[model samples]
Target: MLVALDGVPVGSQDGTQLGTLIPVTHLRLPPASRMEFIVTGPSENVKSAQLITQAIVTGPNGDNDTARTLATLVAREEDDDSNVSRVPNVTGPPWTPRFAGLATAAVNTTRRLYFSENAAQTQFFITVAGQTPTVFSANNPPAVVTTQGSVEDWIIENRAQENHEFHFHQIHFLVRSQDNFAINGSQPVAAIQGQMMDMIEIPYWDGNPNHPYPSVTLRMDFRGPDVGDFVYHCHILNHEDQGMMAIIRVLPQP
Candidate 1:
């Protein structure tokens, strides 16, 4: 499913003190998934406006496809005092977007992270090539081991029916791209590329070969005081408890 504004889907932010809602061109949501976003009215001059768009869903078998009117957005009035803006003095490094492909290409080490639900769909996993899948075990091996200061690109793939949120501890990462088969851009993907963020949403697969699978490309930042073993997992607490989490060991920079 997709929720868009002005023909463009908007992007959502991680749950923070000060929330932000950006008017985007497009955004996608997988089945049984949810996102929180704010939409601005079209124009006060028009009194009200409407958004006419369509949504496509797969049949029970996951083969047959159908499309219908997703929603009709209506403009609303806002409080006069709610239109205040303030810019805080931020310190440290400036946030910027790191383009997709370029981030992985510049780094020699790239980790491919794949996730899927068990046959029952009640459990999930993080699997790496040539390694046993990591489940919800304290003894499970680390997903990826790397040194601090080393730049790495993690291509995360979601092979499940429901959508998932990817989150990590300590440092933030740069989102290269978030695209699956059904929906792609809600915000300026290019602009958000280099910006620092700790969480991302991965859409669900529509089971369409032409659409490809839902995935997110990210550049992990390990250049901070955070050293030693940490964890990365689905932001959804229920999913994390169901084994949708993994450890990532960051050794001191060599």
Candidate 2:
């Protein structure tokens, strides 16, 4: 179980420090998601505190994430390491982001992908646009292909009834936007926008056909030196084992 600190989020998983710290009491982290936060030590008057996680319901039929205590926090004695550096109360000085120019960088291509599962939830798929959904196989050709140094934008929609985590290997992506979800007042979503991350969660869609499926748009950067085939998939072990994954081939730059 991943423990969430009851404090302020200072940085994201990809090491992009936030311009401003966002205070949160309970941070929800899905599979493969990561966050960095600052937790102040307990006051002298406080004896101990428990680090715990709250229960979460992924879907109507999905497994339950049970709440549990992870550890006990106790204040240190006055004589114990007075030289220990104190955690700053304020957000630190500004710094440039690693992908500072990515927001406005020219997009080389755009693609759409979606997640779907069968009624029995035994089979799963991550399908590219204009293609038939098929179980993932190593023998299968790459579902998507691109050349190195290309910046592409992908829209990933979740058509399943249970939540799905989108994870990419070999590179991180910037989350551009979220659509068709009621997140107008979500502090976590607001705090995470524009950060580079290797994983993100797409909420489950209701069965109603009139309701649009939940989706997230991502800005993928393939400008790094790495080149070759890598797989992107739902981080959930069961889902991944059931074929909710696909390969992307990144050709070497000429």
| Best-fitting candidate, scored by lDDT | 2
Looking at model 2, report the run of 10 residues with the lowest lDDT sum: 1-10
Candidate 1 at 224: error in angstroms? 2.0
lDDT at 180 for candidate 2?
79
Worst ten-residue run, lDDT, model 1? 1-10
Q: What's the true lDDT of residue 112 in model 1?
A: 83
TM-score of each: 0.60, 0.84
Candidate 2 lDDT, 1-254, residue by residue in tens: 11221122334323455445667666677887776665776777998899898887676656788999989987665667867787677768755555556777899999999999988899999999889998889988999999999999999998887788899998878888988766321223655576677888888776668878889999999988879999999999999999999999999998
Candidate 2, residue 9: lDDT: 30
